[model samples]
Target: MQEFTLEELKKYNGKNGNPAYIAVNGKVYDVTNNSHWKNGEHHGYEAGNDLTEPLYNKSPHGDKVLSKIKQVGVIKKD
Candidate 1:
């Protein structure tokens, strides 16, 4: 699998017709075109925030999100 930096992932932004992905637990998730779930806005708290803090913790449908992007060939093995 190709490795991507956090800054590289942020470049996607789910805008400009590009897909987004988040690497967690050795898995990649495609969150493209999702208004609610985004790279920095996942779980209502921005990325790099303190996990212990009382923030919006929601189950991110990353798998499902990846499926959508894969269907469109946005996320592919490099």
Candidate 2:
């Protein structure tokens, strides 16, 4: 598996033909083809950012929704 720093993850913003990726609980998932993450965006949440809080607390769908998505990597530890 690959590892990404938050800064490095920012580059894959699902914009300008970039692949969409979001981090949650130290896991990085590919949201490039997820309809909910069209253009790397869902609701007001943008891709290439750590969405742990919103996915765990704010979104009704919850982190369970990520189970269907493909995990590509993990957040790099210092």
Candidate 3:
């Protein structure tokens, strides 16, 4: 499959209803409706301990979470 830099992906000017693109064999695909990532919560959560002696958990930043997905070869467009 072809690989692209993050900059190239950002140039697509994704539509409001489409947030994802696919790249296979140097081709670009707008897989916004793909079942794999159609939902927003597909990304995992984050857990941390608070100074108050309690546990805290929340989702990471969208960009950070997406970056991790790219690192794992789960998502890539540009």
Best by TM-score: 2
Give per-residue CA lDDT, model 1, range 1-78, as digits (tens).
Answer: 555554565565554556655454334455554575564455554432222223223444423444453321122335
Model 1: weakest 10-residue lDDT segment is 47-56
Predictions in order: lDDT: 0.44, 0.93, 0.33
Predicted structure 2: lDDT: 0.93
Which numbered prediction scores highest in lDDT against the true structure?
2
lDDT sort, best first: 2, 1, 3
Off by over 4 Å in 3: 1-6, 10-18, 39-78
Reference-based TM-score of each model: 0.40, 0.96, 0.30
Q: Mind giving the per-residue lDDT tens digits that candidate 2 earns over 1-78?
A: 999999999998999999999999999999999987788888989999999998888988888888899999999999
1-78 in candidate 3: lDDT tens per residue?
Answer: 444454454433234543555333333444344454543212331111011111113423322323233321222433
Choose 1 or 2, whichever is better by lDDT.
2
Clashes (candidate 2): 0
RMSD of candidate 1 to the true fold? 7.0
